[model samples]
Target chain A: MFEIKDLKASIEEKDILNGLSLTIKPGEIHAIMGPNGSGKSTLAKVISGHPDFEDPEGDIKLDGKDILDLEPDERANEGVFLAFQYPVDIPGVNNSEFLRMAYNAKQKYQNQPEIDPFDFESLIKEKLTVLNMKEAFLSRPVNHGFSGGEKKRNEILQMLMLDPRVVILDETDSGLDIDSLKQVSDAINHFKSENKMILIITHYQRLLNHIVPDTVHIMADGKITKSGDKSLALTLEDQGYDAFKDNQS
Target chain B: MLSKTTNPKTMELETLQKQARDAFNTLGFPTKRHENWLYWTPDNEQKALERKFYEPSDSIKENDVILIKNGSLRSKPNNNNLTVSNDTHDYQNENLSFNLDSSSLSYLNTSECSEVITIRCRGIINEPLQIRLESDHTKDNSTVNTKVNLIVEEHSSITATFYHQQLGGAFNLTNTSFELVCKDNANVNISHVFKDNKSKAFFHSIIHMHEKSNCNHISYVTNSLLTRHDTNVTFYKEEASLNLKGINLLTGEEQFYNHLTINHKSKNCFCKQHFKTILDDKSISEFSGLVYVAKGSHEVDSQQMNQILLFSDSARALSRPQLKIDADDVQCAHGSTIGQLNPEEIHYIKSRGLTESEAKALLTYGFAEEIIEEIQDSHLKEALAQDIKETVRKIKS
Candidate 1:
């Protein structure tokens, strides 16, 4: 459902992703593991249309349609979701109000009926039950005073609400505790179906234990160094990216 | 005679114009030499637009109460509690009278307006009165002056919205003065919205808050063309509190100057002033606030914060906060910030599903929402929000 060919991305004239390529089919889960500055998060941001992640040469497609020219919101409308590493803290904007606007924007783009306030409230409540988020969180400003775990969970909650066909999780497990990590994994597992594709981007294998990926790709120096089955993630957990760094030279 | 020859309409306005012109000629325009005008005075560079006079509109539609045309006063719709009992307020108390003797605005409004609308409320009104003053007619230079005095009885609470809506292509000068006599333990919310046209417009507003009364004034002035507004609010009496917030978001050659003074006469009084201005192109925004703590006025708390966001290199802002404390044991502090959008906030919002323009709009909206949300009336809040959004859209578009 997702494909990238020779993706090259940069920031402020500094190249981060050079000739990166990956593909994940429906019903499959993939994990991209790399060390610091290895372009793991850059890959995710590039796919999500981050303005800072400029693509000089590449083609990224979802379901056979080029998405390089689409805006971030337009990509989300096309069932592409990116779970940011750190959610923004927007004061004076109610969390529910932001969600409603985003939800309606996507719905309108997809030609679906917009949800009213009442129905939207109930819908958020139902999703909150799945993510174990408190009702008070809905009324507070977006991520204004949220803890690390809460921000991560809020990201997952958005993924669930939008129900994107191709989900890209960027460092989604970095700040989560064991319990919160399991909850987030459970939420992802609940949405796991035959028609959805998930890409988990992380440096550790802890998240892999909960939501096992069908394939593991080791990224180093802005390009994929190796790809294998789930055993590669386990081997990297025991060994680390040191093995891949040596192979690069 | 000069003003009349330039724009001849009615004998009433011509007579009033002659009277105002004679007053101005005798006592030239108030300058820095005058104590009251020391802190505020237009430079010689600002050419004076000719002031013309027109008939007042007293039509009483609920929506039209706030919508005055020409120089006439319109009653707030369904303001039964505000019985228009015609009685002039004795402006003199001790040696100080709010009524300025040689002021052209005071002379024109007091002499010409034989019938003054006395707006009073004993209980909370279901709908806050909306006063929309519209100026769409222009034969030559036009002038619209109004004096509205609001009195809230003891233990009464009400919210009133005063709107100055000007749309035309003539030089216009409008003056509005309000006296809010809030009896003990009364609360009043006053919101002023100024929507001026492409014509050269000048507006001056003065409000007085009385003893033990709580008053909140939210002023929003957006100049689509060339315009200037001067506002002053004074809080008198012990334990009386006031909040003064003003926002000027403008483009083109619009210029706005706002000066607020809080006179803490009695003990234990507090006041807060927060003003934000968004300027683009060659527009200018000026803010001046002074907190005066009189002798024996102990424990007076006051704070003033002015934040200006300049989106263009040519846009300018000047903010000055002055504090005078006669009492020793008082807390008074002031601060001003003038800068562009925070790069961190912009990046944060952009990381989400928003583009650069979309993220800037959201961040700027959040900054302005601080003052807009403090409005007590829901309808006014919505209207102000929509207006602000429209401004943002214009800036972005």
Candidate 2:
């Protein structure tokens, strides 16, 4: 289980996630929908322990244990993975090499033996099939000269490789074409399991139609104002977020 | 200082040597007043220049590889076409001239050199010729000077590699000069590897290319106490091309300097130069590159780029990429960039599970691999890459 209680986080003295509270249980896919400047992405960043947000008030717990003091990589080692909305381009670093390094890092943290290069190559090759990517993608630099859809797919590719317990997809659907959207959604569905939790944060309800979150929360001014079943996403789609501004808590 | 012409064969050479000695006396050592010698100069020990001649106690036998130890030729390769002579030739017809005359190092080298090793390639050479210049731990506070001349005939090709190594804690000074001439339709590839040395070394090279000649020059310098390399190229005829690339790795308090100049004196010539340096600790590096297109040399294309990566607050890098185009129809471009590693890139790599040091090593290796990958010889590339990796590891430690 993953839990965030009154998580008020600020950057440069301006609060972004203002007293936000949420809980996600295993086997459940929750979607947070909101208008612009409503802290959807900030909540995800705070959960992943971004360095910019300092001295966050309230608590974030994974598996009922406090993880507020962990570094970003430590959080990642603890099964907290955030698929960045904007993946950074790392020139001269081979994609497969980076992935293998990440995988080995997590393995070392868990006290497991590291995989050899040949074995890691085969392992990542299998994951490429899930994203319908070519072998050449592994040889190129990470996210360098990649198309928008390709970058998104690479994020999901990493998610699959790491197999984190808590998966936070922050606007992964934005800028993705319909075909790429379907492919990414399929990859996400394939990664879903009974012991894993997924949080999808987006401004549009279109992505929810593909992944079909079990619960939807309407956010405004950095807090969740209302919560309901999946049908709330369609209602917000038709009625718009303007209809929920009066319900801010 | 001209020894009484005991060898009649060198009487003409003695005259030229006297002229060179006079030139060195007139110009003397470079001072802060010289524009190109602004950042560095010979260490305050005036004895370095005074100890001009040191005879080697050991003699080298003849072998297939040219080996110079303590500034004396230890071995000479026995080849029919290769002429290893202690006498000087009238090299004026070879277009031997220094591009930057602010320093008298070249004149000093010419005046003090004991021999001039010359290799004339007629047909295509199947094997690469290797030259090793090594300074052992036997001597301290001494000076050694050597010179080489290479001429490639028409329709011939050859690859030459020079390995310079200095061992021990001696504060020796080494001065070297290389003069090359490429005839029409000849191909020449040369590589220089300067490895861990505690001595102060200065190298000056001049190249002249005739019509339809192709030349490629590559250099790698690793952890030298103080080193300066000067290379000048002149296109004597149309359709000649030059490709030059260099990488420097510096750490501790070491300093490395590179000065390159290309002169396009003919039409339809091309020249490209790329140089990169990685500095750590309190090391310093400087690069000065110039491409000149002479008058009436239209349709010339020249490009030069210099990049530096600094790893410490005290580490410094300076670069000057200049283009002097006198012809209106010529194309010239130059760019220089000096920056530290990107924090975001570092964070991104660290996010993948590498420690801070490991992340830095990987990034630094990646930065240098750009130039190493351009080397055509796999053996040379692999060896250079391994040396770079070792250097990167030391930086983190």
Candidate 3:
């Protein structure tokens, strides 16, 4: 249900994402593997409508509607969720309070009845079965002093709460221990359905072991150099990106 | 109109002015020239030169009195266990002194006064005492100086909220001298809110603590106009504790100045100071705090912090936190932070589906809550929260 064609995005005046293009339909999970500083996060930020990153030339459409002009919040309202690799530590704002406000804002934008605290608490508790996080995490400030794994799990919890149509995980597996990686993967897989699209951005293939993607895309410099089945990831893992350096997109 | 009454009226104004002018001239505006007032400076261009004493307007019915103005409690009419001694200039009360600057004055009033307002509860109060002091006139020059003495008896606890409401656009001076004696095992919390208008006003306050007394003082001063405020606190008894917090919320083309001093004179006394400031639209704020640890005051633990949020190019904050530790064995540290809003916090809040303005509003509210939560008064907290929201919105707009 999402499509990106020849995407070109820049931060300030520097070009980062050059002529990049990719697509994911309903029920599809795609892995975007790229090395450090390879414009992996920029793609996610551009799609999420981060104000500092602007798409100068490209088209991103959700269900056939262009979303380049939408503000970051508007993009989030349109069901685009980007799980940041390094979660921010928001001090003084209670976790539950933040969740409620966010959930209500999305609900109000979609013309749905807002969930009260009671319902929201129950909803989060029900979903916590996957992440197995403690109740105290909901009371403390969001992500402040949280373990790396806990931060990743918290992102998954937010994704489950928002239940976005297109979820972009920007290296969510990084910094997470093996156990946290499994929990995060399981949570994402649990939320995966025929009506949802998932784009996984990572530097390694370890997460693919738990949540297998339908397709894999290799990114170099600023463009998606290759796209194939899950075996493509295996091939890249074996030969490294050097094999595709000469035959770039 | 220059009748005998009118002439004496002028003479009274002149007499009051001379006393204050002399005191200030002698004190000589604690300046950067002086180490104590180094952080803040009043706008010399806009001075409250003329003083007009309005006849006490009994217009505010007794029922309208909220028992506390800003963070100071009312003690005259009903309660008995809470003894409020008068330390005003007219009374021959024991004088309390501090190393820093102080100005005291007295005025005549016919309003009813209470000797004791008892607060015997042992639990924390969710409704903080709110003292809203409105000027008697909208445009008349004025001076209001009074000493409010709060005494918490042994095995008791209470929280007082004070809101200094400057409703009129007139030049005014308000001096609130508070003395709180918390007996053994008693707890006292006080919150002070200084509301600013288009007038020039100067607020000076000094609070003293007794033996084994625990007192928390919080003040929020939002300046949209020119104002000068000073708060001095001293703890004299062993095992006593104090928490002093000040926040300066400012905007517009005004100069706001604040000088605070806390003195710890006894052994094992503890104190903490935190000041947060938000400035925009060419507004300037100067905040200076000094914590003095007397000799033999062993095991004294204290920390001070000043954080400023600059929202515009011309906004400024001059923060100086100084400490004088005569005791070799003491824990005293201070820090200052001057920066804009955390961009990541703003992005995180915005990504949660709130617009930029909405996200900023939440961040500013959260920043103020760090000190507001210590107030222990729900009504006062809510009122202060409302004021914070309004201030943030005003800055955003």
- Backbone clashes for every candidate come to 4, 0, 15
The sequence of per-residue lDDT tens digits that candidate 1 reaches over residues A1-249 is: 789889998888888898988899999999999888989988887787766765557888999999988877677778888888988787778888878877877788778898988999999999999988889988888788899998899888888877889999999998999999999999999989999999999988889999999999999989998999989998988887787676641
| Candidate that beats the other on DockQ, 1 or 2, i.e. the better one | 2
Worst 10 residues of 1 chain B by lDDT: B90-99
What tens-digit string does per-residue lDDT give for candidate 3 at A30-112? 99997778899989888877767744578999999888778888888888898988888876677888888889989999999
Candidate 1 lDDT score relative to the true structure: 0.73
For residues B1-397, write the lDDT of model 2, one tens digit per residue. Answer: 2333324233455565666677778887877788778888765524665565445526557798788765666787777656454434634335444222425777787677666655677778767788897766446666677677778889988887889887645467788787788899998888889888877888888888899999888998887898889888889899998888998998889998898889899999988898989988999998998899999999998999999998888998889999998997888899999988776666556555566677788788888877887776667888998888888878853
What is each model's TM-score for chain A?
0.96, 0.97, 0.97
DockQ, candidate 3, comes to 0.57
Sorting all predicted structures by DockQ, with the top scorer first, yields: 3, 2, 1
- Which regions of candidate 2 deviate over 4 angstroms? B1-12, B43-45, B53-64, B76-93, B98-102, B125-129, B137-139, B168-170
| Candidate 3 TM-score, C-alpha based | 0.85
| TM-score for each of the candidates | 0.81, 0.90, 0.85
lDDT of 2 by residue, A37-156 (tens): 889988887787666776899999999988877777778888988888888787767888889889999999999999988888888888888888899998988898999888889999
Report lDDT (CA) for all predictions: 0.73, 0.81, 0.70
